[model samples]
Target chain A: MPESSLRGALTEAVLYILLALYTPLHGYGIMQKVDELSHGRVNLGAGTLYGAINTLLDKGWIIPLAGEMDSRRKEYVISETGKEIVAMELIRLQELLDNGRVVTGGTV
Target chain B: MKHIVHKAYWDYEKEEQWLNEMSHKGLALEDYSWCRYVFRDAPAGKYIYRIELLDKTGSHYESQKYLKFLEETGIECVAAYMRWAFLRKEASLGPFDLYSDIDSKINYYSKVINFWNIFAAMELVIGTMNVLIGLVNGGRYGGLGFNFFLGLPLIGLGVALVKLGDPLRAKIKRLQQERAVQE
Candidate 1:
């Protein structure tokens, strides 16, 4: 991956997570939302979500909800950084879809 | 009601499976030391177990914080022995793993290798110290090689750990590179 793409890969888990976190959500909640948002095509595993959450936290892309330290169900909301990353990734994804459309031609 | 099982230093997968199997046998893991597993009687197949590895010489603060984080996610951190943590939760839904994707799983493997490196370094140091001490006391105690021999197990453990984790580390690095280009 290019430096940009590496940073903006927006893997299914990552993209869905960023989308889910647009509204503050807990781990399970995010998992559920990812599944629902992808229309049952993607089922975010707990382990995958857990690791992505940690990575996002490390990058300061997400922050835990207030006083969630001791709570069994902690919530996280996307940060400004997360929003920017999502925006950039969406652009890359848009380009991909556009290029695909061009290569296929407007037959239909 | 209880059983003590001795697990090897790098037997995380087997240890996890064993714990889950024990849970199926109505023995829920309550705690564990380096090689000793403590269990409590429970309904068969009631609990799921997972193991998370930490850096061998992990700090108490970091370990506690991570464990607390796991707890917040509804996983019970039942035991901490050296660099490994034993986590469990109700198995009503199915098995719950702590790392699922290739990248995260690679990271998990890397942590194991890192801990092994730490353990290997510590073993090498301890072995060197033991040999040095044994040499110094050669005439006084007539046990010149005993301390060195005593340290052999540590060195062996270090070697075994390296052997255990090095492959995973290499695989992760290669995968990362290939994945980078593919992406």
Candidate 2:
């Protein structure tokens, strides 16, 4: 894949994370959901998943939902701000899809 | 194999004591040479090593460096910089102070220009009087010649000062307005 197209995957990672946390999920649970949703095409490493969780928490897009089951495990949920951002992203994706359909004569 | 290495040019006695403490904790001293103490099977991540120098004034310097040779190289790792005191010190020096000094100098220049503007009208009056006195004395006193050399440069300098002041004064006023709005 071209380097320029890598940005799309980054955006997809953020969206996938938000989707996985819709019902409040743990770190490993979210990673599993991402892989399942993408049919095993988007497996996230533990380190990468932890780093993403930290970044999302720092940005106020996610928060700890409940107490950890064990010292090594943590649970997280999406915030209201995160929901709004995801909704905005969905609208953007719809617009892109519409444009692509028009430009490709409804083939996309 | 995991290892922790501490680097220092002095404090050999304290380093030895620390090595012994680590040994008691089950972290075997793998090697010690050239101001570095290496340990095997040591827990990785962040750890602080404090060495106290036996000086009258008790001079102290603290350094913070990440020890991540294993993690970076795909091995297990636990490393951290040693703490100076028991408490984590807040960073209160460096770039922050330099930025504040720059802001103060700009503010000072703005005030100096405002002072000059309030005193500028006096120069025209002084220039007129010197020209009049020179004409009245009929060229022997050369008052106009002296004032011309001195007063003209002062006038030019004053004009340059005002020109320089305009932009800085505007910047200061804009900054003040922004702060007022923020408050």
Best by lDDT: 1
lDDT of 2 by residue, A1-108 (tens): 887444331256678898999978876588669878998766554334554677899978998875654434467899998898888888878988999999999975
The 10 consecutive residues of candidate 1 chain A with the worst lDDT sum are A1-10
TM-scores of chain B, in order: 0.71, 0.32
Candidate 2 Cα outliers beyond 4 Å, as residue runs? A1-10, B1-183
DockQ for every model comes to 0.42, 0.02
| TM per prediction | 0.75, 0.36
Q: Tens-digit lDDT track for model 1 on A19-108?
A: 999999988788768878988666665656776888899989999998987776789999999899889989989998888888889453
- How far is each candidate from the true structure, as Cα RMSD in Å? 4.4, 20.5
